[model samples]
Target: MDRFEVLSVFFGHKTAASVVAAHSHPYWQLEIVTHGGLRCAFAGDGFALEAGDMLLVPPECEHGFVYDKPGVSWITIRFERAEDGESRWGGVIRGRPFTDRLVSSFKIAIPGSADKPYEKAFVGGFLDALLHYIRSDEFRQPADSPGALLGQITDMVLARGGRAVTVSELAEELSYTRSHLSKKFRAIAGESLKAYIDRLRVQKAEELLKYREDSISEIAADLGFGDLFSFSRFVKKHTGASPRELKGK
Candidate 1:
């Protein structure tokens, strides 16, 4: 079955300063800071995560944190992808629907919530609810900070599948001028607007090549490339590998 299965769940309490070295895993993980604070680094970018904040780390992404604040408590849910929903993005999650879900999940977990061994099914249910929420337009919670804006941008790209979009289009969709939008994106993400989109495209293309049974040309067109050559060039330029090589065929 292509559904997410909980591998392990734990509620953590830290009383002293600690550092978790960067590491990667083949499965997905969710971390919610229920109390105190933590500085988490994903892909070398540091996000000061506090209470009422959450993080969903995707497969194979290197992440770690410095828990310097005593009395910090968190819930870590490690799960594997038996389900095929790649529409989700990883990063700092805060405010609105996401936070609301975090609180509820913990509330249930604390009092025999599914984050435990005997009640792992509860975690799966929570994940299903989350996936459903993410697939809906209602998931576009208001962004009160740059971090929220970054999540919005990531969601926008994932929502696009493999298609291409311009900065002006993104700005227009977000109701901001091209320059202003790009500046904020760069400041928060530490990457140029175009680079981020292109990188996202490359990631999508790589995923399709590896998993989906789409032909090279078809994948190229799906990503909005004018031709197979252009798509091949893009994949090569960014990843130093051709689609065939990536596909291992």
Candidate 2:
């Protein structure tokens, strides 16, 4: 019943402002732009990633981005070492040769590779390899049991994005106290549970704004916002773009 691994695939359009803004994450991120272009800054060094290009950014690297078009889609995998293990990664651990190999081997394009059935199936293979590698003693030491809690909590969030989520609710589901989950969620996700929830809600809302024809008010209500004004404020705070502007782009 313990979920300690993370494997995910995201395929859809995205905006420039959605990708930009310097931020650091606590887990590894591997991404490939299928059709559009993306510019990312990793640890002060920047590179423009385009169609067919692959990127492997280690954890804790300060990165920001700008996308060329609205049809930006990619896959990302986030994972961590076992608890009490020394394989703790932060602020950009140098990627291993195996990491580079896995990145190069993954195909994230939609209508995927012509030969692949789905982008998920293609990129999912690399994620599978990464998990196997991370579990190996040569790649990372065994971590303690307490550390696995964060991965479990994050898995829940990703599986059910902002769906009736709350600290207390998570605690009850995971059989942990609220305070413990809060602290570990922050430590592992690089943000508080509430913060991650807000980010997830906003990100989901952004996707809807880009792809759906819903009006601002409708979008707001659909995303569980109290009202248009509140949703507008939330979108502005995170992405620095109004709903209209985001939709238009």
TM-score of each: 0.52, 0.41
- Model 2 Cα shift for residue 28 (angstroms): 31
Please write out the lDDT profile of model 1 over residues 1-249, one tens digit for every residue.
236678877789899999999999999998888889999999779999888788889899999999999999988889986646455477876645455655676566655335455477666777777666555554554566676677777767766886988899999988999999999998988899999998998999999999988788888888888998888888999999998899885
What are the clashing pairs of model 1? 2-82, 2-83, 3-82, 3-83, 109-113
Model 1: lDDT of residue 176: 97
Q: Report lDDT (Cα) of residue 247, candidate 1.
A: 86
The TM-score, computed over Cα atoms with residue i paired to residue i, of candidate 1 is 0.52
List ranges where model 1 is wrong by over 4 Å: 83-88, 109-118, 145-249
Question: Over the full model, what C-alpha lDDT does candidate 1 score relative to the true structure?
Answer: 0.80
For model 2, state the Cα shift of residue 161 in Å. Answer: 3.8
| Best candidate according to TM-score | 1
lDDT of 2 by residue, 49-108 (tens): 766555666568777777766777755455443354345332222244345445546542
